[model samples]
Target: MLVEKNLPLQPFNSFGIAARALRLARIGSEAELQALIRHPDWSADQTFVLGGGSNIVLTGDVRQLVLKVEIPGRRLLRETERGWLVEAGAGERWHDFVAWTLQQGWPGLENLALIPGTVGASPVQNIGAYGVECQDRFDSLDAIDLETGEAFSLNAAQCGFGYRDSVFKHERAADGRGFGLKGRALITRVRFLLPKPWKPVLGYLDLERKMAELGLVDPGAQQIFDMVCAIRRAKLPDPALIGNAGSFFKNPSVTPEQCADIIARDPKVVHYPMPDGSIKLAAGWLIDACGWKGKTVGHAGVYDKQALVLVNRGDAEHPCTGGEVMTLARAIQTSVYERFGIRLEPEPVVL
Candidate 1:
């Protein structure tokens, strides 16, 4: 294991936030991970497990070991009547894993095509897009307990998956003890239950429309996957070319009664009733309605193409600082809350 100091973490994170780490360690195997955690330098307050760094905003230099998990491999673990259970290393790029699964004929992950992040981080936030969340297919995760070297397999329920929140993300503090905000539970691997049977979830209207345009009647999972990629490419900016963390805010889901009230106030509110009868309103529409689309307060601004995404428009003198991003997010939150009585929450982990 090579441990470096004062490492630049800006390039690692998708947002391109200029931040450094006091110490950085890249562990390629479970043994190495355990060794580092057991090292004298390790502490609950000074250890952080980073995956792809796609869903985070760094405010300043980290005073800890930004441990980047590099373990890699994928395999079919089991095959039952329902589906084939596939397991992958936590460090695997989520999009690459999705593509590999599609090629291997796994059906469940196709709808989640093109989402940026690592496999381990998927369950952390129950990462979802276009009607599919990680919890829907999550079987289990092999995670290392920071306090104890003993490895434990956490089932989906054990992970406490919630809307953009999980046991790893929202396990907060009340009085004292507990991991609270900064815990070092290292996710080593993730297992997903997928099916060989082609099940196409064409719940998103844009995807359905695309299928219709292509004359696809009851398309298969792969077809849906291709369409989703096309839609995403047209809608979201590529993080490689432009720095962004996909939808910066989660679409606020409210009760049907609340939706009715909002609809009465502004019929233009775009909302879709979820399976549980909860209504999910478009975050982008809300932000745009608040007059933030294509608006730039500094280097950080809302993307011209998509209102839901905040972009770091390459440092035109005043680079996109963390403070500016926070300010814009606060403004949007305040406006949306005042207008619709719904408070929008930032999806990214702001440090």
Candidate 2:
């Protein structure tokens, strides 16, 4: 295992925030990780596992030992009577993996195409788009315990998935009642169970509009993938062109009564009824309603096309700092809360 000191992190993160990793190591295999765990300088509490860096915000120089996961592979693990089990190394680009699965005739992940990140980070965020979430197709994952250097596996239930959250995002309670993995685990491989007799998820408004425009009553998996990519491209700015982490806020869920209250005040409020009876409000609508689109706060600004996205308006020479991004996010959150009485939680992991 080789370690580099004072590594620049501008290229690693999607937000293009100017930051550095004081010390960094690349773990390209399970053996490398285990070896690092046994290193004399190794400290679990002082290390941070970095995947594709698509879902994170680097607030400042990372003092932790940054372990950049570079493990790479993908294959069809097996085929069951009901579905196909596919596996991918943690470092595989999520969008490429989704497209690969579709090319191989698997259809379940089409709706999640074009999402930026690594497979290892997908479960940590329970990454979702349109109407499908990673948890819906997740079979299990293999990980290494940083403290014990022990290999283990966890099924979907063990992951404790919620909206853009999982056990990996939280720390264990003092009494050990909670099953939070947080920084204790490093995901190495992820397995997905793509069901046979696949059905497309077209419930989202953007997707429904695509279907109507194309006059596609029953679109195929590839078609849906194309449409999703197009929709995302039309709405989201490419990280290469404009530094962004896609949607910056999670759609807040409220009680039906709460939705009714908001609707009475603003009849045009965009909301969706969930299967669980809670109502999911469009976070973009809320931010737009608060007049945030195309607004700039310091070097951080809201994307002009999508109010849900927070972008870095500065160039590489004067990149936006993590503080600026968070400041703008906080301001948007405060405005949304003051107007709608609903708190908008940011989707990115602020580190």
Candidate 3:
């Protein structure tokens, strides 16, 4: 329950944007959070829950009271004949948790390896890589209502999962039809259901290339994890080295007719047919097609290797501001829209 004032936030966020939290508190357990809620000066509306800070853009100093979640633990909750139910504290590093699950002989999360952020933030973003998403293996999560200080749980359906979206991402509807949690709930623990008789997910192009190169007809979970990590490292700059939130934009989905129109203009347009009738376009291909790679704007720049990534080009002394990053992102969005008539939505949460 200790509060710090004017806390530096550059190290917390992946973008390395220079910013500060006006007041920050560390919440290490459910009881601590409840105690904070019961404080005389506590205001739920003025607080912001921060996890790994790996999926956000800080436009300026955070005026909201920042609650840095540091609760930590992981264990096999239960094992059934069908699958293994594993649980992790909200503050656990997502990549480390995935690797741990694999080491313990649990298998569903391999394809999502190397993704940035915390377990608490995973479902909020419905994080996905290759062909697997958090919702694919989600069992449920424990959270506390900030206003009421009441604890609750939600299954996958209650999460209302979508492409990089969940109930946590939207504001509560006025009419109550939307039923979003948004700023009202703080996730504490997440449970994952990793099924038995596990089979690797190997549908993405990069993975297929690895299989072909290695002559791997039946690669194991660990092999897929290794390949995913290698591929991501090859294309994305490590946040430790270059400040970046991986894949800045979400792949836009369009109608088949729209895809046909783009294909007619640029026959090389990269796209994949979804299980639904919609077609998902490669956002990187669109940005690259518009000539954005290696381009810089102020202190923010597009990663030279991956057009989908927006990076901080400045050093710690003269770091990029969230404004510069958003400016570059907007410019890229405008260019992609003007050329392809499709709007690219950024993936990171902008604050």
Candidate 1 Cα misplacement greater than 4 A, ranges: 172-182, 316-318
Candidate 3 lDDT, 1-351, residue by residue in tens: 789999999989998989999999998999999999999998988989999999899999999999998889999989998899999999999999999999999999999999999999999999999999999999999999999999999999999999999999999878877778888989999999999889889999999998898899899999999999999999999999999988999999999999999999999999999998999999999999999999999999999999999999998678899999999999999999999999999998899
Candidate 2 per-residue lDDT, tens place, 270-332, comes to 999999999999999999999999999989999999999999999857779999999999999
Better of 1 and 2 by TM-score: 2
What's the true lDDT of residue 342 in model 3? 92
Candidate 2, after superposition: displacement of residue 12 in Å? Answer: 0.2
Residues 77-129 of candidate 1 have per-residue lDDT tens digits of 98888898999999999999999988987789988999999998899978988
Q: Looking at model 3, report the run of 10 residues with the lowest lDDT sum.
A: 172-181
Q: Is candidate 1 or candidate 3 better by lDDT?
A: 3
TM-score of 1: 0.95
Report every candidate's CA lDDT. Answer: 0.84, 0.94, 0.94
Model 3: colliding residue pairs:
none
